[model samples]
Target: MFGDAADAMGGMGSQEDSLVQIGVLVPLSPPGWAEAGRQLLGGLELGVREVNAAGGIELQLLVRDTAADPRKAEAAVSELAQLGVAAVVGEYHSVAARAAAARADALGLPFLCSSAVLDALTEEPTDLVARIAPAQSHSWRIYADFLLAAGHHRIAVAAQTSVYWAAGTSILRDHLAARGGTVIELNDLTPAALCDELADSRATALLLLTGTPEPAVAIVRSVRRDARLAEVLIGAPAGQPELPAWAALLGQDGAGIPFLRYLPEVFSPLGARVDAALRETMSAEPSFVAFEGYDTITALAEYLRVGSWAAVSVEGTRGQIRFTRTPGVGVWQWAWPPAQVADRDPAAPDRFRVLHTA
Candidate 1:
């Protein structure tokens, strides 16, 4: 859900209060991951309402639009710092998060990345940086394991031409090869090209590594339309299942195609509550970004309440929420959210079901 419910509380607007201020940096408009940002805002607003309803300390938010641009994200950090925020949260793009993290580090502000998953974000230990989403590399291993367990041995990869996609594909290729899986072909992602590649290769499975929803939908449509690829198992190694628009765009072509994502509702009561709240408020299914955004706010509120990020791990909707310092990204805290492999049922293409939780 979006602002229908939270707009009444002025959740994303300026609040006149002496309470603690947290900067919310998200792509709220064009060039930003707007849909994902909207979902995140829904969860964030829900977290705010829950915290306040429970008589937590008063918290005000200083919201900024990053537009998924690194330069703009960096500037937003500076502006938030100028606004005297205690910490910052929200950002779904890895590139934007990286830029914002650097600026946050320089500004001495604690930053919780809600969904960005570039591996280098945690390579160095700094007190200012932490992430609620695991690095892309971490998810790849989980996806690799899922593919192998699903009996996929001969795999072909069709990836979008981006550094992020390239990094993940490389890891997938290596991990699969180590497990005796063969990568029959690798090529740039395109609907027609992928269809031809799948037909030409002896692969039993095709891995589509892409970040955006349009291309992913196109690739899935291509596979469904091509007789040669009709029987091939399709795997989206990134967070396609987490995209709010994926199923709607994919339609019946989404049936049986497995995609990796962070699932907050797998046996978590808190996750269920958050999901239900968002659905009611936004009139849409909650995505992984929403779960992470909610958790980031919950975690930050806890930090403000207890005066220590160390003692504030909540049973996050995404997973057991705890922070540990890792060598990468120099952030003092990092959260490794649990991953899942999910798919749309052939009988009910609109319904997404979890195939495996990693």
Candidate 2:
């Protein structure tokens, strides 16, 4: 009886030792942007649960919210590190990502990011920092190409006074010039001033890179109010999902204007399958914000499962995820809409399709 008891105890100990634990750090309440952050956290949780349900992952997940503050981000990282997480995933803001990356680097924990677009996040690219989202520069290039291909030669680039716009302006300017489209006006415009400028530009197109949706709506309303600006194409950053207002406000005229977008088929069949699986498990829809979270956690889990520490590359639903030899600027695929299809369906924004490069 004593020998049988000993064997049973040994088996129980082995079973308990098989499980592995991983850390998932996210913003519980993203300051100024709660919805997007909530979706991100939801996706991460669903991904974790899904992985566990399928024969269970070797790693268990530890989750915490960063509150979207840089200081809080640092604290979250520290907390996760103290918990002895093998990897940390989180904080959608680029600034917050950078702060957490610094902390993760210090603690020797791998940090994966979902929504941070600023180029500065990976500036010091330690092995710890990897991103599922393409850099901001890539978005600018796609937007510029979209304008040029739409036969928009003389363009006006307007944006709010923010760092996001500042970085985008330089890249947009370069790409516009390269494509032989002159950026005739590059100014910071408030809601009221923006309306006045659009009314006056008489330019072929207006490219807006503002973070807030208010100004884009204002531009559309101003254009509708004036017939001269009616034919002028209006474009805004793809990140903001408030384009429905422009359509509702301007009706048919808004349909004629283009909104630059990346991953235009984000809700298509392929995307829908992934989204549906996540939703069914987590009870939420997926967004660009959540995509990074899902991909990062998936990547790290795969890395842990495969024991491929030297393998610097992985494939994500959005694009390639890999580390570059460069200390900063990890290698990633920027899946932009092909230039030929930039204005493919300006009249039907919802029906627009993306053409990927071969």
Give Cα-based local distance difference scores for all models: 0.74, 0.59
1-358: candidate 1 lDDT, tens digit per residue? 1112122123422443325677888888876768888888777878877776665356667788888888999998898777767778889877788889888877667788888887776435665577788877777788888889988888888776666777777788788899999876566646887788678887889887765566667777878889877679988866675564766777677778787778744547777777788888986787777877888888876655554556667778866677776554455454577778888888998777888886
- Candidate 2 has an lDDT of 0.59
Q: Which is the leading candidate under lDDT?
A: 1
Q: Output the number of the TM-score-best candidate.
A: 1
Error of 1 at 283 (Å): 2.2
* Model 1 TM-score on a 0 to 1 scale: 0.87
Runs with alpha carbons beyond 4 Å of true place in candidate 1: 1-18, 264-266, 327-329, 332-335
As a whole number from 0 to 100, the lDDT of residue 75 in candidate 2 is 86
- Tens-digit per-residue lDDT, 12-54, candidate 2: 3235334555566565563535555676777676667656666
